[model samples]
Target: MKTIITSALVLGLSLSFSVSAVADDDAMMQAAGKELFNKCSACHSLDSSKNAFGPDLSGVVGRKAASLPRFAYSEALQKSDITWTEANLRKWIAGNDQFVPGTRMRHVEITDKAEQDYLIAYLKTL
Candidate 1:
């Protein structure tokens, strides 16, 4: 009985540490993503209510493409059925042409998967 209780306690402590590590990793990733957004800040607004050249990205993680009421979206994006999941966002960032052909964002150059992951993480904060 004592051995079983000790093992359970060890397992619980290990799980706690694992969760904490994940939280730390997420925070670090978000920070890296924020730095990457400096390039995008020229066009995209992180504020939900503020639309810049691009629509505000607040709460975009699960949002439908071209759904922001205040901003004008390209016809292709407007017609798209995409829900902004992480995978879709990654593709959009790396190359919108491949993900959604005819997207107006034709010159975006980010292609590194790690960088995209960080940017997506930062975007999630908004």
Candidate 2:
């Protein structure tokens, strides 16, 4: 009985440590993502619905592309029928023009996958 209890305790502690590590990793990723978002802040606003050179990205994850009524989105984007899934976001962030031809926002490609992941992580928190 004592051995079983010790084993259970060890398992519980291991699981707790794993969960904590994952949380720490997520926090670090989000922090890095926030810093990387500087590249987008000039054109995108995460705090409000106001449109700038780009539409507000306050809730962009899971949102439809070109869905903001107030913003004048490119015809291509408006018709693309895209849901901003993480995979799609990765593609869009890497190259908007390549992802959707004739996109009005001329974003420089973010080629580094890790950086893209970081930015996406930050965007998710918005």
Score every model by TM-score.
Answer: 0.82, 0.90
- Best-fitting candidate, measured by lDDT? 2
- For model 2, how does the per-residue alpha-carbon lDDT over 1-126 read when each residue is reduced to its tens digit? 999999999999999999999999899999999998889898887656465788999889999999987889989999999999999999998998999999999866888999988988999988
lDDT of each: 0.87, 0.90
Tens digits of lDDT, candidate 1, 1-126? 999999999999999999999999999999999999998888887666665788888889999999988777888898889999998888788878878888777557688989998998898888
Worst lDDT run of 10 residues, candidate 2, spans: 44-53
Residue 68 CA displacement from its true place in model 2, Å:
0.4
lDDT of 1 at 1: 100
Candidate that would win on TM-score: 2
